[model samples]
Structures are given as C-alpha cells and as structure tokens.
Target chain A: MIRAIRSELLKVRTTSLWWLILIGVVAFTAVAIAFNMLATYVTIHPGTVGPQQGGPDSLLTSVTGLYTSGQYAGTLLAMVFGILIFTNEFFHQTATATFLATPKRTLVIGAKLIVAVIVGVVIALITTVLAVGSGLIFLSTQHADLYLGNAEVLKSIGLNWLAFAIWAVFGLGIGALLRSQILSVILGLVAMLIGQTVVQVVLALLSSYFHVKWLMKIAYYLPSSASSIMTSPHGADGFEWWAGALILLAYGAVAAVIGTVITRQRDIS
Target chain B: MADGQIVVTGLTKQFRKVRAVDNLSFTVQPGRVTGFLGPNGAGKTTTLRMLLGLVTATSGTATIGGRRYVDLPDPLRIVGAGLEASSFHKGRTGRDHLRVLCAAAGLPANRADHALEMVGLTPAAKRKVKGYSLGMKQRLGIAAGMLGDPQVLIFDEPANGLDPEGIRWMRTLLSSFADQGRTVLVSSHLLSEVQLFADDVVIIAAGKLIRQGPVEELTNLDGAARQIRVVTPEPDKLFGALELPRTAVAKDENGGFLVTGVTGPQIGKAALAAGVELHELAPQRADLEKVFLELTSGKAGIR
Candidate 1:
C-alpha cells in the first residue's frame, strides 16, 4: 500500500499537470483576490471608487472572504486533478502497465484517492497563500488592519483548504466512475460550473413563483452548495459547517465505492 | 523450468457477439520458447491478455506455476509480461516509465536503467516516449517486460516494428530467456522468425487452435509429399522413371525433376535403371512457413 501510494505520488510529480494546475490557481485566485480587495477597499473608504457594491460589513468578514476568494476555483481545479489521476491511465493507454504492476486494482485506486486529497490540499494552500499575500498587500495599501492573526479569518482559510481536499476526493470518484479523461473532466467542470447553478436558478424561480419556500431548499443539498457552506466564514443558511463537510464527503464516499467496484472488475484491455 | 511452466486449459473469452478465444488450450514448458502464432484478429492478443489477467476469461483457466496471475504473490517477480506494445505515458521519459513499474513492484530504481541497458536503450533513457520511433517503442516495451527479470516472460507481437537486427536481438533474448530455465511465450505473426527460435508452437486461426507441437514435429508432419530435388543431366529420363506415381514428379526451375513419395535410394535405382546421371539429389525438409500455411489451411497470416 505504501509502495502504491509512493507510485501514485510519483505519477503526479512526473506529469506536467501539476505546474499547469498551479498556473490555473494563480489565474483564478489572482483575479478573485484582486476583485475582493477592490470591493473591501471601496467598502472601508466610500467615495474612493465608483458606486458601492456593499461589500462585507466588517473587516474580519472582508478579510475572510479575501482569504477564501478562490475556494471554488481551487476546489474545481482539485477535482480536475482528481479526475486526471484515473483518466490519464486509460487516455495514455498506460492502464495495462499500471494494472500489471499492481494487480490489486482496488489498492491502486485507493492509493490514487490518497494522492487526490493530498493534491487538493496542496492546491488549496497555494490559492490561499496567493489570496492572502495579495489581500494583505492591498489591505496595507488601503490603511486597513492585515487581520491575519484573527481566529475567524484563520478558520475560513482552514475550511478553504478542507474544501479543496474534499472536492479532490469527489473528483477522483467521478474520474473512477467515468474512466475517460476528456469526458470526466468535461462533465465534472459542467456539473460544477453550470449544472448545479442552473438547477439552483430553476429551483429559486419555481419557489418564488409558487410561493413554496421548500422548493429552494433542494439546491442547498447539491455538492457545490455543500462546498459553499463548508468554505465560508459563517456556514451557509441551509447547513452547518460539519453537515456541509459530511454531505460533500458522502458524495465522494459513494463515488469511491462505485468506482472501486467497477475498476476491480474491469478488464484493462 | 519446473515452476515456471504455464498451463492454459480450455480458456475461452467471448466479447459480446464475437467469440475472441474459443476453448483454446496450450501449455508452455519452462525450458523452451513457445511461439503463439495466429492471423489478424485470431485471438492471439486476447489470449495473451487473458493469461496476464488483463482480460477476464469467460471460462477456463490460464495458470503459471499452478496459480492464476491475479492470485500470484509478487506477480511481477514471477511473470514479466508485455501484452501491449504502446502502454506508456507519452510525456514520461523511458527511464521514468520503467522506474514507475519498478516502484510499483518494489524493485530497486536501478533496475529500470538495467532493463533499458539490456534492450540497448541506455542512450535514449532520458528521452520521453513520444520522441521514440516505433522500433524504439518496441524496445522500451521489451525493456519494461525485462524489468523484473522474472521466471516467466510473455510478449505479444513484440517484433512489430523492429529492424532485422532488432528482431534478431529479440529472438536471441527470448531464446536465452527460455534457456535460463524460464518460461517464455511470445505471440507473433512472424512464422519464419518463430521457426528459427521456437522449440514449440501453438498455432491458432479464427480463435481456434489449429496445431501445437515442437517445431520439428509440426514441420516434419507427413514429410512424404514434399519432393526430393533431382537435378540430373537427363531430366526427361528421370521424370519418366518416376512417372508411374502420376503426381510424384514435378518440374523444377533448375531443369530437374522433384520426386515425391519415394526414398532417395529408390529414386537413385530408378535413375540407374533409366541410365540417368544425376548431378544433385537431396531431400528437402518442409519449412515452417509452408507447414504453418498448410496446417492453417492457407489462412495463415505469417508476415
């Protein structure tokens, strides 16, 4: 098992995917931190910018948002990393060599799951650092407290890391189930970016038109929504931090089980 | 030689509507190179994949050392197999590719370099596989197969893109592997090449076994019909002497007669009686390519 884990980690390290993903982390988090800093800057000192968008009321909330600015992007990239872990084996036709080296398919997939979580955590860390670094400098320029030592600010960043980790595992499950690199990445991105948001919009519209408040509640159960609840400073309205974490983890658990079972019985050819 | 023997019993694999392998059974002895010969889509690759446990068998068993591949403890150490020629990452260097396998199998990292050196790929070890030519890729595949230095070796179409020297090198390598009391089974369409090194052959056509035996036994199978070459000064006289058998005599390009179903001494006596002086008269042993063609009933895909 240790050998498998080492091999999986090596597999990721040997590919160019890690650095490419880092570039994405920079692109996404840089934009997000820049946007969050501008909003916070305007909120703290009104009349300095264009019409107010009404940013977070408190400095802690503003800094927390700044720290977790790119949680969604981090999680999305983590999922992509997770999907690639499994898909690359088939896409590159290396499944034969991989399975041949370790005949126990479940062990290989399990090792990959561990690597996926590690990768997710790593991506989250980088994004957090980027956001925090950019946010701190921007805050200093605007004559606001850095707030890096605040516990609430720290907790939000911690959850941001946790969100990346969980989403990565969730991505692995999807990759294992799909097995095709292109399809898994595409579908995973679609579900994260458009599918869940589309469902939430439809549910919200239906609830408002029918005056049924219960209809909008279904949207909170979605993976992205659960992720939102866990990564925020104050948990989302629908679920607590732990509940959100559990719900997101449950999706990963189901995917891992189904994926492992399919992979175990699958013929490598 | 004793423990490395492979016994495939009634192995059958059906892929939906297509029956890829049909009750195919063959055993490979450790001390001999066994050639698994077949035509295109003749289930050669499918059978090798089944033996390696890469593909599930619908029925029957393929066991090495009395255990299925999946059940084998430390399979890579026991069985070094290269079932796919191009099962590698394009971005990874050849050394890294073998090292990955070495890591997975718990072998030393140096073994990757050793395997690459064995296949004459030491210089290109640092190059990514995408930069490799077809023959280079084939060598990489063989290098990967030898990574474990196992007791059993299996390769499918291993000589697909090798040059003549490369083919010769592989032939010698496989032959030597078997000679070292290791079981070696190679599936290929190169009949003449297999004829050179294979001790035994398991021939299949359309997913069914057509023949299986020692190379000598399969080639010398009913050797009577293959004529003895007769280059004589009096070709008409010798041809007429063997005319009693009707189809016994065939005209040759050398202005001679090829006599069948008759001993060399009998042909000499017939020539003596006809007063035909012969310059050359030698028995021609049937080549494997011809025998293979006949056994598969001309459906042989011997490349």
Candidate 2:
C-alpha cells in the first residue's frame, strides 16, 4: 500500500497537468478570497445592520464565510483532480504497466484514491492560507471584528479543508464510474456545475405546483448541496456538517465500488 | 511442468462470437527462449494479457511458477512483462517512467538509470517519451522488462518497430537473459528473426496451436525431408535413387536435383550404386520463414 501510494504520487508529479492545475487553484483561490471579502463587506453594511447577533447568514457567519472563500473552487478543482488521477491511467495507457508491477488491480486504484486525498489536502491547505491571510488583512485595515479563535469560525475553516478532501474522493468515484477521460470530465463538470442546480430548481417548482413539500427537501441531499453544508457557515436546510460529509462520501463510495468491481471482473484487452 | 515454467492449460477466450483463443495449451520451459508466433488476431496478445492478469480469461488458467500471476506476492520481481512500446505516458522522461515502475515494484530508484543504461538509452533517458521514435520506445519497453532482472521475461513483439541493427541488439539482450537461466517468451511476426535467436517456437494460427517444437526440428533440419541440392552428371538416375516417402526431386537451374525425404548419405549411396556421378552435393535447407508461411497459410480465416 505504501509503495503503491508513492508510485501513484510519482506518476502525478511527472505529468505537467499537476502543476497546471495548481496554477489554476492559485488564481481561483485568490479571486474567490477577494470577491467573497467584498461580498461580506457589502452584505454587512457599516453603521447599519452591522454583523447580526449569530444566526444563519448573520454578521459572524458572513465573516467566517470569508475565511473559506475558496471552498467552492477548491472542492470543484479537487474533484477534477480526483477524476484525472484515475482516468489518466486509462487515458495515458499506463494501467498495463501499473497492473504488471502490482497485479492486484484494486491496490493500484486504492493508491490512486490516496493520491486524490493528498491533492485535496494540498488544495485545502493552500486555499485556507490565502483566504485567511486576505481576510486578516481586510479586518485589520478596517479595525472591524476579526472573529479570531471563535469555535464556529474555527470549525468552518476546518470544514472547508474537509470539504475539499471529500469532494476529491467524490471526484475519484465519478471518474471510476465513468472511466472515459473526456466523458467523465464533461459529465462531472456538467453535473456539479449545472445538473444540481437545474434539478434542484425543477424539483422546487414541481413541489410548489403539486403541493409536495418533500420534493424540495430532496435537493438537500445532492452532492453539491451537501458540500455547501460543510463550507457554507450558514446552516443550510438544518443539516449538520457531519451529515453532509457522510452523504457526500456515500455517493463516492458507491461509485468507487462499482468501478472497482467492473474493472476487476472485466478484461482489460 | 516444473518450477518457474509457464503452463497454459486448455485456455479458451471467446469474445462474443469470435473465439480469440481456442482451447490452447502449451508449456514454456525455463532457461530457454520460446518464440510465440501467430498471425494478426491469432490471440497472441490476448494470451499474453491473460497470463499477466491484465485481461480476464474466459476459461482455463495461465500460471507461472505454479501460481497465477495475480497470486504472486511480488510479481514484478518474479516476472517482468514488457508492455506495448506505445503504452507509455508521453509527458514523462524515460528515467521518470522507469522510476514510477520501480516505485510501484518496491525496487531501488537507481535501478531506473541502470535499466536505461542496459538498453543503451542512457543518453536520452532524461528526454520525454513524446520525442522518442518508435524504435527508441521499443528499447525503453525492453528496459522496463529488465528492471527486476526476473527469472521469467515475457515480451509481445519486442522487435516490432526496431530496425535491423536494433533487432540485433534485442536478439543479443534476449540471448543473455536466457543464458542466465531465465525463461523468455517472446511473441513476434518476425519468423526469420525468431529462428535466429529462439531455441523453441510455439506456432499458432486461427487461435489454435499449429506447431510447437525446437527451431531445428520444426524446420526439418535433422530429417530426410530436409532439402538437399544435388548436382549429378545423370539427373534422372539421381532423381530415381531419391524416390522415397515424403521425398520430392525438382529440376534445378543447372539440371541438378533438389531432393527431400532422403538424407544426403542415402542419396550418395544410391547414386554410387546407380552409377550416377555427382558433380556437386550441398544442403539447401528451407528456413523458418518458409515453414511458417506453409503452416499459417489460409489458417487465419480473415481473422
């Protein structure tokens, strides 16, 4: 297992895509921090409705949200990172050599999953540093409340990191489910970017028209929706962060199992 | 079979309608080079894939050293299988590519450089594979195969894209591996090249074994069927003397008789008894290329 992980990491490092994605992460994280900071400042007007007491979308919640501004992009990128790591084996045709070295196919996929986690960890760490650094600079300049060392604020930051890690695993699962490089990537991006929103809106509309309130609640379980529970400081649909994490992880686990079983039973030729 | 020998028993791979490999059974012994010959789509690649555990066989079992390839705890160390020359990450350098294999196999990192040197690719070891020509990639694949210095080596078309010079190098490399008492199984369409280096040949056509024997025996080098160019003052007498089962006498350019089914000694004695004076007697053998063509002709069945 250790050797597999090391080998998997080496495979990623040799490719130029890893660093290219890192650059995208850097720029996107910076932009996310700047924009989220501006929104926090605008949403909480100075000398009027300044920093609400402590509920969903309150001043404290908004301020903590600024600290994890990169969560949206971080999660998405981590997911793509996961997708590529697994799909690249087939894309670049390295799976043969990989299996030849370690004939246990599942072990190699397991190693790839571990590599995906590392990618998420790195992305989470980078975004956290950038968002926190920028937020600290903004708060100090205005002499506003920093909300530093607050438990909720700390939890939000940790969850931001956790969200990225989990999303990466989720991405890996999607890649395994759809092994084709172009197909899985396109499907993943579409599902994460538009499919969730479209489905949620349609479900809400149908719920209202049919007077079925339960239909709208189903949106809360969507992978993208559940992920927001971890990164978004505001309590969404009254679901806890841990519940969101579990729901999101469930989707990934199912897909990964299906992918592994199919690969194990199918002929590579 | 015995230790370190590859055994494929009643192996059959059916791909929907077409039987890619049909009840194939053959044993590849250790310490000798066994050439796996077949026409296109003759299941050579599929058999190799199944043996390495890349492709799941529809039926039968392929085992090395008395265990399945996947069952081996350290398979790479026990058997180094060479992939297709084109199966490489184009973005990575040859050295990096080998290092990844080493990392996966738990081999030393420096072994990558050693392998590159062994294949004479050290100069371009740092270059990305995207820039490599087909022959260079072929060498790199061989280098990867030699990484473990395993007791068994399996290569599919190891000389597929190599030039004559490169083919000679590969022949030498394979010879040395077998010389070290390692089992080597190579599948190639180059029958003449295989005849030069391979000790034994496993010929398959239409997904079935056509022949399996030593190169010399398959070519009839020791049999009466071996072609012998005969030059005599009386061609009719010599031709009549060589009339035997499985023997044929054909008129040569200078009225000499090319005889089969009768040894040179038998022809000599018969010629002397028949008062046929021989001007020239020489062995003109039919090489493996001829035998392969004859055996595989019309057997591939458009597959």
lDDT (10s digit) by residue, model 2, range B122-201: 99999999999999999899889889878899999988888999988888989888888889999987788798779999
Docking class of 1: medium
lDDT of 1 by residue, A127-161 (tens): 87788888888888888888878878888888888
Weakest ten-residue segment in model 1 chain A by summed lDDT:
A51-60
Model 1 earns a TM-score of 0.94
Candidate number of the best TM-score? 1
Name model 2 segments beyond 4 Å from true: A44-57, B221-281
Local accuracy of candidate 2 as per-residue lDDT tens digits, A20-136:
888889898888778877766665555445553443346676778788887887789899999998888888888889889988889888998889888999999988888889898
Report the number of the highest-DockQ candidate.
Answer: 1
Error of 1 at A206 (Å): 3.2
TM-score, structure 2 vs. true: 0.91
